[model samples]
Target: MAEKPGLVKTRQERVETRLRQRQVYNERMSKKRRARPRSLNIGDVVLMKNRRPGSKFKTRFESGMWAVTRVKGTLVTVTKGDEVVTRNISCFKRYHGAPADHQESGNNSDHEEGECEFGRVGGTAEHWLASGNLQMGEGLAAQKTTTPGSPVPNQDDVPAEAPAEGSNSEATRRSGLGRYNLRSRLTLPERLRDYVCE
Candidate 1:
């Protein structure tokens, strides 16, 4: 059989071109594979991906966030109450805000554990904050009175008067239909003189 001119050359060229294209494609994919996944340290908060198909309107993530107790390779461990679960790294979505109360306990042991965790305990500051007595800004504590007359209310609004037994004024105020007449003087009608006498 006579060899065709340029057939071998063209075939060699086509094979070489295919090899080069494949190498380029592989290099691009390798670079992408080398790209780092999101790093989740211990104590990080994460929302787990719920594999169970929920209603179309329901969210993909699990309800409430879970705190990362341990991370091993591509797996993460999360706890809820006494229940613990280990899931693949791909199954979790990073939580951006403050973590739940579980993470707060880890904050106290941060020094011992050599890692600072997010969240805080319910301390005196938090108590005062809840009670709404915590004052902020400069001069807030220094200012004794909110206005000219009223103080910051360290004590009761009305001062404790003497017991009703000994004082004549207290006895009269209590004995008089001051007890029975619940209506204030300002509310009394001006034309009720005849009714008052009756």
Candidate 2:
């Protein structure tokens, strides 16, 4: 049987949509490739705009900056406002703004390898570990342990389990590793540190 006119239009629309999306993606990728740096690290703030209606700031810096809180290969984690962004080093740095807490968070060690987007002098995981700040490759929140003002573990390498909802991870104590819902953005470690500040 011959194709129906409705089906033809529908198929055409789908093809058009796919082509448009692919074009946009290609443009973005090429732009990133042209702009990426040799190395990338944590704590760099990207300058990309992600403004919406009724938002506070328009620019990334004014919007609280996109801090390169975590880095692992092409996947670099950055945060600005309520938005947590993860992208490749080149893509992120190309549009990233100035960082927040660049020095304190980025350069935990003096003699180490790799770059830190947050600070000028990049260090290594070992350096950060030596400083007693817990960090992972990516996806780490700015939270600390009992000593206060520490970084949260990025993944299950440390195995931080989130408390079974309803139970207050903070006020209520648990035996094992976990990430308690302490704040809108921060996990239990950051919340614990805030508790100290308070």
Candidate 3:
């Protein structure tokens, strides 16, 4: 089909108007950021800003540390384990500490060969176990059972009705094996740790 002579100009004008509006919006927002520019580099670890729920509580500026996987235009992509999230540049703040990946690399060799690959040197799991601060039904036996070499068997490994070989295995299975949430296992960089806690 042939275009009407008058219609072409109208279409071009509409596109131009939209572009102009977008440019204006960008300029207005960028003006504030320009005063203290925080340009993100690849491999720079940043904490994504989290909005608080409707409650009588305020949250910290930085919530979770995510690795800068990619940057395109005004968008940044970050990853934590299997979770990959993309947000606008304004949604993240530059982490003023060692990167999460760097910290993990430094400590990866220190851990025992068969210990669970979760958390930092002193974390919630360790604290709870060491202090013997757990529920009434759950005892220290469950905590001691998961040794470096032999982890608690999964649901597929042992039948619910059947008993295991040792008392440790029995306690582990009864206490619920493979129950730890990976999300909670997330750890922060050492430098950033003190700042966040404060």
Candidate 4:
């Protein structure tokens, strides 16, 4: 049989196409985890990592519950009863622990003994974060007053949770004091620049 001229080249092209498809699939899988930070208003019930398991990893869950009055970084500062927990994004599963029914028809929403609706806080979280402190003490210790004059917060902007002493100033800097003095002549996209944190 006559040898084909581009058979080898054709096979190489096929492999490259498959590799690109696989990359797209992997990107899509990770995309779901990258949810945009939204307004987690006060009193909004949220779930966090349940680290205080009595036993080993065999019988532990990650569906911690609390109410959000403040949010910073990936942490949503929440208060549950007398205890206030500031959880990193890892320890949080928003919207009532990922609606059980929204998942599958067979899975149960209720928390389990050996596992949980969400997941567990991995060791990497502690490694990545400097302060994972939970304060449920006196009035000043619990409340955050980062905003100037400590004006009473309405619905969207709750009373500033007690940020670390210098943290507030840092937050202010990060909150875009530098960006204000940008080249005023530069034109920024309306939607792109309008991420006013409610």
Candidate 5:
């Protein structure tokens, strides 16, 4: 009768140990497994995987492009002209073709057609430019004014002449290592001593 309680206790301990081991195993596997890419949307261009047996020279995906018409769970419906086909999401790879508007306009709407003459000033300008929320000039202008504690200087206050050698101007300081200067100009012997040669 006493053995019954001992057996029950040991059985419960074994089950708990199994649960803990399984939890740890699952955590380890989850780390190794890659997260799936973003789901395909309607109107997305995709290439269907070629399942036919072929030589090494044959391409993995078919040459023709297919436009995603519908996405229902794991299944995706794609059409190329009159021919329509339904296949698993894994069988189709997203195709990033040139935008229809870009083709028609002959210019990319995302990027303005102008040289960015000024250097990027701050994080606000970088963020705005990256997000496409502001144009290059507009972002730079915003950066100049929006920066706290820094007073916006008028056109009259700007210096006409470039800073002389040894001057500690803001532009001089920011230019740093990239700007060619007499100090950075080193002899072959000095270069060998300073830098590690392959």
Candidate 6:
């Protein structure tokens, strides 16, 4: 009966030691881990992670935006149009803009009038090029000519000049093969230069 008290004391000591070790391990791991965002709420917009197989250039999140309908602890329920999905908060990234409903209704006055859903003030890249607002190899030139407060000039107003004769810039821009061609002109090693074909 006297040995029972000693055994209980030893077991208590071991349990206390293990608890201390566990606490230390948890503190170390918490420092390396990223804190989850706790500001998520209903009506907030967020983008869900995309798991589809794609090239390296593909976006990490889906293009379609989802609005948070319900937030239950770590799980968030989102809806995009007719589609509804419930996923963990870790799978979502908070979107920083007005909700789609406000944007569609034109109730958001922060955006310019007639701004496209994609946020382009004007039309597409082709439209900009056709309007002579943009040109090949002259994007920087246009920016340079305009002062900080001055408006950009139309490319149509200024005549286009032909590139200098024998200039490799145009060739390099048209085909990447020109850059590789320069490697062939490098002098061969001394040992390889002495060998001549019959």
lDDT per residue (tens digit) for residues 1-198 in model 5: 456555555777999999999999988786788546457877666778998838888888886666677899889998776678999898999754222211233333554555221122112223322334322233335444544334456679987987677576666666764454445664457547867543
- As a whole number from 0 to 100, the lDDT of residue 179 in candidate 3 is 42
- Model 3 residue runs over 4 Å out of place are 1-38, 99-198
lDDT of 6 by residue, 1-198 (tens): 456655555777999999999999988787779554477777666778986748888878886667677889999998766578999888898765332222244344655566543223342323222233221234334445654334566769888988776456767645645555554566778888887533
lDDT of all the models against the reference? 0.58, 0.48, 0.57, 0.50, 0.60, 0.61
lDDT tens readout by residue for model 4, 1-198: 888886656777999999999999878876877756465654455556567766675433443345566777766787755677776756665543222222232454553555323223221122112222222223222233333234334557656677666444766566654445344446667886875433
- Residues 1-198 of candidate 2 have per-residue lDDT tens digits of 887676555777899999999999988998987854446555443544343435554443232335567877677877644567776554543332222223344355753355453334443333333343332212222322212234444556676677676465654434333444244444467546656432
Question: Candidate 5: TM-score?
Answer: 0.37
* Runs in model 6 lying further than 4 Å from the true structure: 1-32, 98-184, 191-198
Ranking by lDDT: 6, 5, 1, 3, 4, 2
Q: Give a tens-digit lDDT track for model 1, residues 1-198.
A: 999886666777999999999999988997988856559867665678878856788778776556677889988997554468899988887665332222234236524444333333322222222333322233333243344223345457758777666455656667655544455544556787457532
* Sequence-dependent TM-score of model 6: 0.45
Task: TM-score winner between 3 and 5, please give it.
Answer: 5
Each candidate: RMSD? 17.2, 21.8, 24.4, 22.2, 16.7, 11.6
What overall lDDT, based on C-alpha atoms, would model 6 receive against the true structure?
A: 0.61
Clashes of each: 0, 16, 0, 5, 0, 0
* Candidate 1 ranges beyond 4 A from true positions: 1-30, 33-35, 99-198
Candidate 1 TM-score to native: 0.37
TM-score of 4: 0.27
Regions more than 4 Å wrong, model 5:
1-37, 99-198
Model 2 CA lDDT for position 114:
57
Candidate 3 — worst ten consecutive residues by lDDT sum?
131-140
